[model samples]
Target chain A: MSHPTLQELRDQLGCLEETQRRFSRTIPIADAVDRWMPHGGLPVGCIHEVKGASVASALAFSSILSARIAGEQGNIVYIAPDRSLHPLGLLPYGVRLDRLLLVSARRSQDIAWATMEALRCSQVSAVMAILDSADLTSSRRLQLAAESSGATGFLLGPVTSAPIAAPITRWKVSSHVGKPGQRFDEPAWALDLLYCRGGRPGSWTIEWREQRLNTLFNQLATQTTREALAG
Target chain B: MARRFLSLFCPDVTDDRLTQLVEWCDRYSPLAAADGSDGIILDITGCIHLFGGEDKLFLDLQRRFHRMGIQSQGAIADTWGIAWALARYGEQSIVHGGNAASALALLPVEALRLPYEIVLELRRLGLSTISAVRKIPRSSLAARFGSTLLWRLDRIFQQAEEPLTPWRPAAPYRASRILAEPISTVSAVEYVLHDLLQEICKRLERNRLGSRHMDLACYRLDGTVDRCEIRTSKPTRSIPHLMRLFEGVLETLKSGFGFETFVLSVLDVEALHPTQLSLSQANPVEDESSFNALVDRFGMKLGFDQVNRIRVRESYLPEQAVEFRSAAVSPIAGAEWPAYRIRPVRLIHPPMSIKISILIPGGSPVRFFIGERQRRIVRLEGPERLTAEWWRDSNSRWGTRDYYRIEDDQGLRFWIFRDSSEHWFLHGHFA
Candidate 1:
């Protein structure tokens, strides 16, 4: 082959880096999420922001994600400042209450510190911090700690207009009232992928019943059709 | 290599003062106790050499007491009785191993520690000295004094045993240090604590033991003792882990005039067989690794109560259905909650009352207002009646309730109940 131009060589190097990132360790949460993510699932050793209109909605989603990240041998540490999280509700999500450590701290700084400490532990597979607010500095510190121990972290808080930190992914989940006639069905959530680094962002309506996530739409098929159309 | 005993006679001192002296004398020997009301007994069998000899140790103790404005006379002998008798009556402070009989013969009959009546009776019988009493037959002494005189004689002559109950139980594992210059800063205190932790951990390792509870006592120059204690979920002897637990406590320690002495005592220990260090730490449970350390850190930073593990109990009441236990004190076993009625993930404790307006009287609520905010219900699925647990409390105000799981128009699910008094309250959320 002819000698590659400088710009072409740079593009090839960038493509190699993207490929390497795609192979990073991840925890597959659902088929739709896995197919849409560049890494095939939620990336480990990084922070994911989960914001919602209600505290309970954000908490419900975080608890489900925490349970999945903390597999059979790992533990989940939840730093809850308000102490409002009910572990009984987590039973339906298949979270082992025994391996779940609940730390009730009143101050936001204390919550952040406890979250970082839990994230640094190799035995802890995930840490979820439910606090009022966090800054860029604390977020970066949590990111570094999680990366060092290969533990995933979730910051669950209320939706705010202010830009806080650039996490690996940002998701906004709100309650989805099913079609008017199907209002009595299982709990459904309107999940919006607001931001995803190196991956395409998409929205989907999913339902949680019998301890599994069921997508309301055929996201995989729709994604393929869109890719073909773009090509 | 016979055991040595030391006795000190403190004159004109109150009981509290004597107790303090007994505690202070722990520096000389571990087995130190208050003798009656006026004296202290110390089993300094193997501890005398630490101070360079029995004579120097005795003098040092007396000099320290004198400096503290207390009058004290001390003596060391082969037995506590001899030491007590000599320290109170005899001028000699140190008695050699042998010559027990000769030493006893020179003292008065009262040296036997007999009742006042018996001493007077011996004196009246012309037995003024121990030698004179010894000359009489032992059976006669027992018959005259009712075995009290013989017991005293046997104790002094080393024929009987008298164990000293220490001021405080001597911890099996202990390490202490007396700084030449008192330390006041946090760094200095931590440094001393570091040394003490190493020393205690070494002893624990030597005996294949691990400490479950540890206490650090800082004896200040102002004569006040400040102590901090830590309890672990599992027995451990790791120096770094133990040091981390003490880090928070050291900040709150008041080094009034500075801490002159530091003592680390392992109050509780259990058998901990040494395990071979593995090259790969694949097993977290067996390692007792970072997870426990994390618990300990959180326990220290926040109150131990703040770090909790939740467990479900056998109860119908939602709040009572789950219990939060401190992870520092109890081991968390795998939780297998029983299948029960559907429960909300977030429980609003002390449920808030709401105003509800229904289209049809006594029918399902169409809308409810919490404060000024209103929420419209789109679907309803309840009327599950729950009666008050009469056995729990006879005077409970909650007589009965009809619970309903209602989904608002916005898709938010709420568990609400109407009491017998016709009041609606929002209890939980199914978010």
Candidate 2:
């Protein structure tokens, strides 16, 4: 019949609040790529969009993100609806299939639903949802679910001509041709910062080499004019 | 003697899939139990010899489950706690007995399930591996690392006892057959079922026991499996009784293209004491086992959810009431009703908001607007006020709720509630 003590009340409140705080919040990634992301880390409870000109470029972008997030301990849930990805192809990029969970959803809507469910788990570090054809309502629902779960989602889709409102940072990727007469020429990649929160919107051309993307914008401009004149 | 164990960690399990995984693990070993959020502890113990040695047994398990399309990783060790630790943290398989100590030498001290902050502190002190921490003095380790860590480490190293609560008791009799050629026809299935029944009956007769329940599992060629189980009203080892129970179930098997193997296991067997037979009841005309088999077939054909049992809980709160669980898994044995507080049958998913006009000491509501219709309250029950758990951020803005079971003029009863200040909402209805 007596009122509960102050310490008892504090204990009850702590017990109720402990469930949400039980999740591990560390962003598992390699030290090198972790330095490039904002806050020196990928922001939790947000979405990152990867817009690519071709399927190959979209896959490459996803592989890079997957390798970065799935560095040592944490795992990546790749929800692929459009294409079947070979696990061996991603190994060289540092994504171990043992640590990577591939969920093949039949429909685009199911991918979003599964992604929402995957994000709720504290064990999953990041989710790569290949949104081949997602409408605005489903995309909004995904964004809300990602926010609630405190997990980051990478929305990978084709580059549409029409501009769409994205929830987080959007990067456009395109393949570039390499220089001639080079035995081990670098793989070219052009990245456009289409949309970013409080970040600069600029373009950067990079060549994939030695487990890192090297900037080749200044070097490519001079060679382009000579090739144009020769043609 | 060397003891072998298998620990499974499946982290991708959602809220709905956890029950299925638990049941699936029960098929492999009776000692299986849930570990944390996404792990299963299995006690292989003396059963490893059945599938050959430990390595071959692990491979056989992996291949069988892989064929079933469920991804899993397993580790074997000398102790239950160590097996649990290595399955989640170790890079390679930790072999049991001989190499357990060497295998555990390279693992991090956090594998002992110590607090995260303590592990961080250990890392900061450059004490990263289990071997490194083992070098410290026992007294110092006990003082600095806390008694819980020491106890867990001792349990893992086999210096302490750690027993497992098994999923089911060990069954005494079991029979299995591996087909040289996969059989697809119903007659072939019946032939195999008869062979299995004969084998089981011989074993039971030698032991002088009768089975209460039996399980039949058909491992198909295409990796899908079908299971048909039957429970008897009394202890039975009769071949005719068993064959009749499996009669109708054989027609429903798809064969999944065809079955490569079949296994039959009997459980809950009791010693059969001979008694004088009555003439009227000798070999009863119709057995209850056949009736149960028919219900099982119908339930499997219609869907598992078609058969259900009502489960009641002990609570004064109405919404904490009763729930219906599948008859196959519900813990309620023999459908005995327990004494519980009466509660309304109908409950809304999300309580609907309503506008109300108060008439008393400005307390209780006389009338309320529910959707487009207005209803007048005839009598009001006692108000039971409840508050939300404010510690949850999702419910931070939730106010206090006062509930009342009200009767309307149309003789419809509603469980309505008012908020901390006087706002009303229709929470549920009485059936």
Candidate 3:
């Protein structure tokens, strides 16, 4: 009957957000990985952070997530400070060059700002940001924007950076480049889900094939033998 | 049909004062052309009804000028030629449509807009007025004054006529407002633009029309113009969308010497019908109108050429498979993208030349160095031979290329190709 105060409106919005979370569609992972996710799979509207030991592994993980969301008919926005995510490099990971839009910002603050802007556009399915610095304030702003717009956001950062408490999920990926003199058929990745809201933390060694992660690459061909290589 | 044209002549007016005089005349009609350095002519054909009639309109205009402290002479005639002749030489007079020729005959030869030297020569020959020059035979007039004198006689006598080119083209839609005092602030410019847009959009709504291109003219107190233009791919009548396009444009402009008047003109328009909304689920941010606004905002900040849309091409060559096009265009319908097979996400243009050491003479590569990084190939997968038409003009660059997906010791994948000359080039990298 009367006009509601700002606090009461915020409380009402919280109730609406909780109800909306129940109806959100979950992205299904592989047979062994579903149980590890908070919603049995990744949530569509939440912020998911991925930290990698090296640039290669972190980029690979980001590409995998982008491909999954943008697969057949959606747009993916990548804002990077380092100008990575080469359209050529993502080809093997099943990401199309035409579907991805890349933005190269000179500063880390710009990358964070661009990520928030891209997320606010409902047409974009996912936003992958590579930033060296993101304080709690900017991260919270990005999170709020992503939630209201219903677009997923991923932060790809180094593993050694100090941890921030804004993202809902934190993941760390490490690359295993076989041995000094040998190379394997597939690149193996060690994915450690460091934290997830209302979910148990887990780790898995994943081998990217076709589109999703499946095998662990346990000596698929036993590194080329010297005599076999000679023949 | 008989139409009325008014010509105003302000003596000794030049530069800024002259332009300001012309700006003040825009109130009577939009088709007001500055006849010469000190004159303005208006096509008051259908506009006299607004201020009653020609007598009332001219009197009202004269009263306004008297109040503004600007002195000027005025005359009205059916043709611009006669009106121009009468306003300068004769007293304020209205020449009837059928009697314009006789009325203009007694005026001085300068009324024909002739060169001063030509008028002086005519006066020296005892022909002072236009009527005196008209008495001479046509051939002698041409022979003596080099044909221009004959042309001027014809114009004054209503024999041949010329059209007037207004300083600003008469647009189909235009709205303007004048302020009591000049404003030098940017916010004042926007406030005027917002009100003008509201007025123009109302008339567009009445006629079921939408404007695609518009221009904003700011008439400063110094009589100079600061103009900005906006264009949209689709015809739109929405005021907010148009205002959004002008935000960046307005920011870049300097208000410089406050403007006393603002005019918004619609340069191009098209018939637009109301759009029907779908009942099903829709994302608020990704609607059709918002998408256009987003593109317009991008064009505002960066540039229109920088925003691009991707389109699929049928060419089998990886480099030719997709093309980037201007964002204003719509993608070709039913043009399916070539299914992603083994294509790399990032392609190196012109194929970066590299040095490779293969394990065997005709076998896979063993080691390769691209740039400063050297990598040993641990696994190799191709020789996918692709050959082009030998008769093709561009095929002279390379006859054939064998593409291979090569992996190195660092778990990095590359799309490297070997040309007919047996040289390896890195074309793309795989994640």
Candidate 4:
């Protein structure tokens, strides 16, 4: 029997390549409710920044994003520079801390560098960079790295600083203080959104209701007015 | 002294479950080598003593193989080639070691190592038995069968040596314990480990050697065994150090029922000569031993996958500078440093697209509207152009990005870029 022709070999090679690509579908997130707006899940090839004051909210957001990605069997690298957050905080958020690679950085600069590196690995589904400070230049480099690695980046930092250009979505988070007239058990939140790209930065007052985050804009008016008077 | 050798063959083996079988055979003899495709060859030289002699060792080997869920045929002979042949063609357990000629008397002519066609010809000539083949004229046999068959036959009869190359070098010390009654308790298991540890330590002390790594195998009554392996920073023979290394392992040893026997083997041993050390050299500020112990404990408790070290790489590209490695393994040290440049403390995932109100051509935005609030741009700098990697994606939908650094009225600097297709997007900001 004669050997197979190069043309026939090429056809077989093409079939194999197509089969490989068919197997490359994105995995589903675990918490189905906490899906990303654009891609049903966080877009695989973009950087997402979560800006907040307290480490708790920032980590909560990280845990939520991590849980969704991990539920799909995707891996994440979480780089923290300032303080170590208790893994127990993530348990309530439905995150398996074991699935997360936690790296502690002594310097803010190191944290940024580490985050960029984590984003470079195509295997990593998402990267959460917890920074005490992030300037414009570092954010741009991180965004570029995220695009190259095909991983979603989440930047967590203070909201006091002017908006950095890095994150696709910028969330402004404040503490949800308990109501004075209401019972101590009342859940509270200070959450806002500056949808700079989509236009109109809407502010929302939210509280945890029955294990779910609920916006209570009406009740927050009183609190906002009181704070305004104090200012 | 009968020089007995056992060749155990287990055909129809699958890859998923071969490690346990290999480890099981390791307990019997350290000289076990994988043979043919699936068989394991054990040089039972001097190893039968622990089983109370040769015959008892053979019986025990059979029973253990059966208990471990493996079907095997074994043959013992003065020569490895004869044992191998008999195991495949003859009976379940073949014992032949009294004399070479008598041992080959009943075996088929094919056992003489002749090719299939030659063996068939010999059989047609009424030379079915090895004795009949031997009876043939030696010069005629050599001329017809060639030197290959004659040499193989001589090797099988122990006239020539057949060397066996083992998969791994034979470990210097091996200690095994078989509980009279299946021990289920953790304390009872620890009690047995002490004896094995002492034996291994004694062997090491006698050899004037130290082991950097060791493997502990707990052979359960159910035929399956749990393995705990440890590596040390320095070559050590101390029983206490070995015990300490196994502390976390011992805590998590779920008997699954109970283990009746245990085996401990020392690997990668090296000569460790004691030397006089100065006070500073002996007592360093950071003790690697304690640090390693702590890392090992945390790794074991939290699972080794959870521990990782952050590594930095030298790259002009900001995102290419750092990575993470498993904490157990050290990262490569001393890389050339990249040129120093300002990098963000934080980078957002999927860069947020911003709507710039200004119509500036190449320089920077004079003012940009972010959300409802409009911020006037003050100082404008940079039009650093970065092209997309087109080689990665041939379709090349995304074009080049012209990046700019602009400061707003509030002195808030931002990194904004315009894409190749001329669409503008706000990429990042400097605090």
| Complex DockQ, candidate 4 | 0.04
Q: Pick by lDDT: which candidate is best?
A: 1
Better of 1 and 2 by DockQ: 1
Error of 3 at A96 (Å): 8.1
Candidate order by TM-score, decreasing, is 1, 3, 4, 2
Ten consecutive residues with minimal summed lDDT in candidate 3 chain B?
B283-292
lDDT of 2 by residue, A1-231 (tens): 224795467556656855223222424323432333333434556677877775445556556666666578766767665323433334445555445555555665666666666665545567777766555776667666666655577777668733335655677877554444211212456666666553334466665566666666465443543453354
Instruction: Please give the ranking of all candidate structures by DockQ, highest first, separated by commas.
Output: 1, 3, 4, 2
lDDT of 1 by residue, B1-431 (tens): 78899988987889987877777677777788999999999999988777798878888777767766788888899999999989888878888768667877879988888899999999999999988998989988878878888888888888999777898888888788977888999999899999999888888989999898898888766444677888776688888788877887888898878887888889999888887766676653334248888988888788889999887776666766678888866664534555556667788878889999899988999999989999999878778787787777842465688888888888888889998899999998887
CA shift of B302, model 2, Å: 14
Quote the positional error of residue A156 for candidate 3 in Å: 5.3
Residue-wise C-alpha lDDT for candidate 4, range A1-231, written one tens digit per residue: 224795467557656745223223333322221232222333445666677664456556555655665565666667775324433334455555445566666666766666776776656677777766556787777777766656777777767645566565577665554443321122244555555332234455655443355556476545654563455
Candidate with the larger DockQ of 3 and 4: 3
Lowest summed lDDT over 10 consecutive residues: which window, candidate 3 chain A? Answer: A220-229
Judged by whole-model lDDT over C-alpha atoms, candidate 2 comes out at 0.63
Per-residue C-alpha lDDT of model 3 across residues B263-290, encoded as one tens digit per residue:
7899999987766656676633324335
Question: What's the lDDT for residue B379 in model 3?
Answer: 69
Kindly give the stretch of ten consecutive residues in candidate 2 chain B with the minimal lDDT sum: B334-343
| lDDT per residue as tens, model 4, B260-372 | 77888887787765434458664432232333443443344444444564444543332334444566554456244332232332344445666676665654566677676
> Over the stretch A69-153, how does candidate 1's per-residue lDDT look in tens digits?
8877779998887667878877777678888899999987898789888888888988888856657887778778888888888
| Residue A27 alpha-carbon offset, candidate 3, angstroms | 1.6
Q: Model 1 Cα displacement at B3 (Å)?
A: 6.2
Chain B TM-score for each model?
0.77, 0.58, 0.73, 0.71
When superposed on Cα atoms, how far off is each prediction in RMSD?
A: 5.4, 32.7, 8.6, 21.4
